[model samples]
Target: MAQKNETNSAKDQSNASVDQYLAKDPERLARNLARALEELGKAAAAWTEAREKGETGDVTTAPLIDMVRTFSRVSEYWLGDPTRALEAQTRLFAEFMGIWANAIRRMSEDAAADYAAPPAADKRFQDPEWGRNAFFSFLKQAYVVTSRWAADLVEGAEGLDETTRHKARFYVDQVSQALSPSNFLLTNPELFRETMASDGENLVRGMRMLAEDIAAGKGELKLRQSDASKFKVGENIAMTPGKVIARSRLVEVIQYKPVTKQVLKRPLLVVPPWINKFYILDLNPKRSFIRWAVEQGHTVFVISWVNPDERHGMLDWADYIEEGIRFALDAIEDATGERSVNAMGYCVGGTLLAASLALMAAEGDKRIASATLLTTQVDFTHAGDLKVFVDEEQIQALDKAMSGRGYLEANRMATAFNMLRAGDLIWPYVVNNYLRGRAPLPFDLLYWNSDSTRLGAANHSYYLRNCYLENNLSRGRAVLHGKPIRLEDVTIPIFNLATREDHIAPAKSVFMGSRFFGGPVEFVLAGSGHIAGVINAPDLGKYQYWTGAKPEGMLENWLPGAKENPGSWWPYWHAWIEKQDNRSVPARKLGGRRKTLGDAPGEYVRTRA
Candidate 1:
């Protein structure tokens, strides 16, 4: 009997330790669970009172109560018997799903009653009934697919230990809850709001949620910044005064230290996206494409646009071309005493470069020797979900909203992006970072996300109207310099790089530019998304390349022509770039004024509201 008692005690301790590990230590999960239970209890009490009053309906209070009860029960059950955690989680999920479904149905019915009118072109928001039907359809299809796949997984899964099985069960249950109808409405409020205008109650609720999210996001930013500064960083390259290029933003060109004072390499100009600072191309010693180009005996000069403000609100697409890009091109010409320089642009900056090229062509200027567009889009017909926000009505709304302010709000742009992947980007963080009082790790990409800049309203509005809505650039209908611009006009050698899995500009949309440009186009499909695809340096050995052989057909055919080679695209591009002429030219002043813009780089970027 004594031995049995000792064994039981040991088992309990073991179970407790396991639970602690599973929940991520003792402090966070334990207290969070307790507080959640208290909230649940309060919700239950509120529901009971509301039911007695008969003021509230079945939708609002019921789901809240159900969720609270499930959480409370799960918390209690886990505290008592850690081994039963899986069962508790499953029950919690099932109950949560049931409640969510009921709530969604109720909301749909309510929304239908409110928005039974004709669908105006401007007001053709997503229908709630349609959404409910779609949700059910998705749930049915997902379950059928998942179950078929799970049959195979479960065969191997049967051999798994108790803990692993528990986690699997928990995950499946979570999926079920996520598929609930109520969740459909909650998850896609932007879609919902389009069809059904939110009343005061919903508006207040949404504002509250947004406020909470903003607060939590700010906290996460602080933590991320603190953690990110600890990572190893590279040296800051010097340029013109006030134009100091750090490992962050690269800009300004006066006198640069040539590699050997041999002064014979041809003059080169680099064009980078203004959406982000130029340091992405010059991340570090090994990763910096600028460094690589310079090392290969080329006089490389990069253009850095001034981060715009209210004062620059009047700035338009033409201003960027004439003042920003054209100025830089001329500067490089004068600085190197060469007629033209190599130009490269990434993303929107690439689009601007193409426009500048068109302008130059119209003016009969021949300064551009070679132009490289990195993941730039000429046609945006298939620009994906981003199009949903670029409709005429929305553009007008944005124009009006920005007209008063003069600048497109950075936070607003960030919010639109967050809406794209609420599950992955927002809610998980809300649960982990805010509710649980834990800080998220600092990721370089997230650091870039935090470092956002506003756009001039005129520039942003023009881009949306012309590029996205009209699809003008690809159709050769875009007007530049008071003439219909055709990409064929600027017949320069072009190298375009696109990523396979870019969510922003899908490869198909970007690839259409190949046909648009009259120049010899060399297109390379890199592996990864927009940001990671561009930042893929030589040392990052996790990318594949496509030969761009298979004609751009469906995705499946496009896959086969693409060979899965090892190594980053950086070296591949470097090798290709080195093949170009390496004749030397003396550093001569460009056609632009030789006014010293202070020192190496400018300090205008550091100033923030």
Candidate 2:
């Protein structure tokens, strides 16, 4: 009897163990099983569709087939439990929705579907009302329905016991706001215009273009791959190994190979914005601004901001001035043995240079002979659409998100810039690339657009809050290295250059920097937007600008001093720079050059991400 009892007790213990195992992680097992079932269902459905429709194209069937097979394998692994299988099914269903979303985004509309000439009678193409109505009716409805379905789930997340839901909601809201329709429309008015640009007689041309996009199986505007192959740093420069200062965020300083004899009397220092790589000014021999300065008989040196690491989490606007600008200035002085140098700051870098000049003036360091600000803003009151993304609530939210990450990821920064010109930056590309299935040309600007750099969380937050959102820099409330700096205190000769159509730094807003400088100042309104205006070469025929009396406030005043000049802004700039030239003083030692390293330019910039 005792032996029989022992056997029965052991069996009972084994059964209990099995039950406990199932109880411990029922949800995970359930999810796995459901996912497997979903996969199998998809596979069967695909096979049936392929057989019925006989569709074998790469675009139509390959991706779907692969997905079906993948899900099938998943289902087979968890087929034993029905509950688990159902859970997998639900998860897979959600994934299916995502796939559909992507597919719908790429689908061409009726006009885009036909490559042939569109009928002249289709007034819809001319007025854009037809195209707009068709798109909004279908897409907007789908979006509304989709959101309505997800609304309960999003709200329900709040009622959940876990904190994950709350945090997830926060992130979702941030992303949603970043992609808000108002922001999108404001940034890409061009897209709205392009689609709506056609009049009754021109309707046929617009429809045909849309149709060609569909027939070619290309997206409206494909995003070309980035080419970081052109500009190199350390390899091109004849510097000792230690002399090169590289921030992954920035390329190395450019060393100009002297080709022309009539160089400037003073050594040149070029400052670029941290948002872009320095190569914008050094793209190619013909287009390179840095090269032009070098050929002008000037000893040119540029600053390459190092890419920020997570360790730089606490870096702020003042930190950049103290470390980045101050360090570069000291190095330039040491290398060339010059006590003072002509400083040209581009965009945000110009803003920092101005602030630093103020600080330097307070300390009585007049090392800056002349200060030139290119497409920079000192005051933000008139800053236009750039403001739409930086309101108090948004900045606070961004601060919270970056608070833990230490650095703002590059993708986030790229998204913000893209939002600034949605039509130009986003939609046409969406139509050509995603919908039409074509890639963009290998253009230099396109390549640069895809290359991005990260900013430390603290630095970015401080900039948005202080400089942009609050306009503190112009207000004289901005602090640098623990000291308050005033823009008006800058006594150096100031040259403020602005682009007439620059959305980033509107001409009027950039003009304010001169008024605030309280010193000898000259303002030049260049042709085109931010980048083109700065890159305008004197020989480039497609350019013009103006320089004269300032315009009054609150005027929609793009053409306040507009004129059709004959040449690019480059030669004009050279002339302006010549006027500021002092007597050619012998290059004195500032003390940092150890030895000549190797070549004219360097290879540090070639290092890829």
Candidate 3:
């Protein structure tokens, strides 16, 4: 009886989960769809008239033409009689209504709910705008329903190719973005009240900023950046004492002064992601991983990548490896006279570092003793939501955009990343900077995020098509320097750190590297998202990490055998590196032959994109 009761309870929970997924906005959606169809019709007619009269070359008509065409494509999927997506939505919604009706029947009999967790979408509805009035409440709920409906509609589509599926998902997400309460003046009562409280000054300022942003960024709006006054590089951020040992078109190698007299025998070289500044590792004293590493009695050197412009647009990933990593490695060896160095890479830097190491191995070079990758992806098969924009049409559009500018603009990339977590990264700014007319708060991470980098046309296009679109990197098709590069060539032991909640490189994606390697691997599942998970120092003492033996099988299979350990994963990494084949040696002097290339944070880091 107890076993039967347990089975029944589990079934009830599963049913409740499905109900939540399908429940919450059919009538509201139908009405909106009807309203939208009417507006689309009017716009289509007007655009058709403009096109027939040869007046459609104007900006407004140009955009209207594209939108009208997009509407036609969407209609074929949603409203077409043959493969009607709307029919599926209606059927699913009817099933949900049936569930609701049964729940009502149960309520009539006073049957108690067996308690289930609320979905994340419902969390935003707790606002007074949703709860204060029935109309607003319906609107809020309706928005959630429509957003889910759009997502479900795409997920349920039949006979769609990968490219079509990708495009459809992106279009649906745009629909959700358009319908967010934060986007509208009247729909968001809180923002309307904020505008009223500010006496329309907020609207005026928002308009001014919007115009300025459109002008400066070519219709791109920036959300946040770290003020130099608040985050001075040498003084507050990247304060770890270091001297530039090597300077190249691609990188500036900074060899940090050892904090201890006796350091690890092998020198440490950190390769940060080229997408952002190296200062992220040395952000502030409290969160500086570089500082922590130096204090651990290890000689350290870091590469600061150049903020490339149109001039560097011809440089590819091969160029990045040869000019960036190889050059930096030689300098580190030249400075310290240590041929073997413990190497570390963050994000894409890690990806490149692994590739470089593999190439070096193939070429009979074993200068790199060990490697540590933090929040990096070696496999692109599961690169998360960013894959939404990786289809042929989108890639072609991006290629055209890059061709116009000679490189993929920073704002364009930032916009995509921001849209991935719109509620967290975008809508708050919309409410604060636009509605409330408030200045952006001083935030280091946001500043780093906003301080975007351009991807060279040669490198960007190649990487996008080869790695992301084709998944060539993991499949052993990525050839750099005339020879095929495989992660299996990486014989050195690896310490791979991945954040549990990293949306950029999902933890499972990082774990896939375990299957790609040729030697021992230690994969630590850290707490928090990508950045937060990495920079979390031991002092913060927040977010626990999980540990498991480097074993075979699926991510799910591995997780069941893992043990959770509290606090920062940094110390664990330090201990792991120390336990490796390292011996104590006297701290080496800073610079030698390379005529100290300016100060620690080199000229390249200060150049604004």
Candidate 4:
């Protein structure tokens, strides 16, 4: 009777504390809630307006349809046999039972209770309350157990083809991530505490921010990854000194100012992926690959691709090769008076450059001395989760969607990329920005990520069909400008750099692609993911890279024989570049014969999607 009375007294004290917090700012919270409602109405209006404007297309439903179809196949395999279905259910039920037992033990203050825990890397359940409080502890354990059970179901299913299995896993992951207890305000302990302390002002501010972001996206939620107002392109971000020496309908060739007295005779041309702006290479002086190359006495010329819109819908791969790559080559020759220049390409840009090299080889155009490919793939056999979205039905739907607008919307591509690591990229922001009502800290990388670019219908369609779907490039079946371009024909020395943790282009895929090239290939594996791995500066002395014999049978086989080297691969690559041609010439001014269009970043990058 005394213990019961003590428990009741404790409960009464907790209720009193909550009431005290609630009464602290009732009038303020009431006014804020009214404002929040008004903002929500505005957000709804913006969404409705966008729908009326036909901005959000049938593309959204296509994925849902594919997901359902894929899951149906998986379900058939399991549900067709009662035994298998029973086994799956039993497995999940057993896990839940164990979790319930553990929860009971924890509630009884049993220190020896073996509580189910989240992975150390999972940031969601970092709060002390998640482990200490019985309610949150149960919620966390239940979510973990359920998510793993779902994953196992997809993995254990039999007779499903590789693609179907892959889609099933991806879909399961998406659903699990979306349904995580951490995503809900009430279920999340930290968010719940903030709500109580602030008297719901956090939610009011969050709603206002949501409305502003929706309006900014012109209907879509822009999903602010960073405080974007903190940075600008030329003034702070892309501040590398350079001039747009030449311009075309598709690209602007920027020749960076020489920081050294003499530079390599072979002018270096950097072809960055058009999916995002070229400033990624020249993000800042400390992190800029272009600046580092210029400082190393190499005449750096970068291709600044236009953020395509309706007018660029008709431009295909052939047009990109002609107007973008070849045009830059011509401008490079005119500016430096150097016929033989070294070339580099990054991601999709690398793919395009490889194709162009094949075309150039066929036409007896030997302007390019050597080739450097950064985190690139000519083969897509192991292209990772991106393949989940690239089958026939989805592509057709995408084509229809793009045909209406003449381009794929910027946010569409951004959202797909974000989904690749939704736990890291999407939910954290959602919880922080919307639930916590805290603005994201200023991050240059996130800022660049948010500055997305639209994809031309013809170009994107061609890329998806040829590269991801057919795998034609490495197979020597890729046709360009009425000629079937073959990678084997291009005998130039190639430096292929693959990031170890790349989700976009798996290291194995890159290793396999090395076999397609005709020339001597130097395969280097860098640490970190696609972006951080490539942009790593030697001055910072971060991350490691590996160099080995020519990419042999498989990545697994190559790993044991490889020698690990410390720090950035920049110096090693520079050494290789010097070995190719050590001859140096007096540093030439910005432009020669080609007319200067504008400053380094140019007008094209300034045009936001």
Ranking by TM-score: 4, 3, 1, 2
lDDT of 1 by residue, 1-609 (tens): 999999899789757533422323345435544554554454445545545654222222332343344344434535566555565456445644654565556554634332122234412123333334434334433343443333333233334544334334433434443343323333333323321331222333332333443333331121122134433323242222122222112235433345544443456666676666565665445566665656555566666556666777777788777777777766665545567667788888888888888778878888887777788887785575556455555677677767766776555566456545544554554433433334567654565554456768888887888898898877778776677877888788788888888867778777766677776777788888887787777666777767656334544566677667676776666556655655655543322344555433345334332
Better of 1 and 3 by lDDT: 3
- Can you give the TM-score per candidate against the true fold? 0.63, 0.61, 0.82, 0.96
Tell me which residue pairs clash in candidate 4.
none
Candidate 4 whole-model C-alpha lDDT, 0 to 1: 0.90
- C-alpha lDDT score of every prediction, in listed order: 0.56, 0.58, 0.73, 0.90
Clashes per candidate, residues 3 or more apart or on different chains = 22, 54, 1, 0
Q: Model 1 scores what on Cα lDDT? A: 0.56
Could you tell which candidate, 1 or 3, scores higher by TM-score? 3
Candidate of highest TM-score: 4
Q: Lowest-scoring 10 consecutive residues by lDDT in candidate 2?
A: 194-203
362-401 per-residue lDDT for model 3 (tens digits): 8988989899999888888778877766756567766665
Worst 10 residues of 3 by lDDT: 55-64
Tens-place lDDT per residue, model 2, 1-609, is 999999899789767533432324446535544554454454355545544653222222332343344334434544546765565557546644654554455454333421121246622123333233334333333333343333334443322423233333333433433343323321232233332232111223323333443322222111333333542343332222223432222234543444554545566777788776666776555677776676566667777666666677887776776676666666666666666788899988887788888888888887788888899888887775566556555666666656665665555566556656664676555544432334455567666666566677877877787787788888888877777788888878888898888978988788765678867887788888999888876656767887665543422453544555765777777777788884554333222363434333344333322
Give the alpha carbon lDDT tens digit for every residue of 160-229 in model 4: 8999999999999999999999999779888887776787788888888888888877778889999989
Q: What is the alpha-carbon lDDT for the whole of candidate 2?
A: 0.58
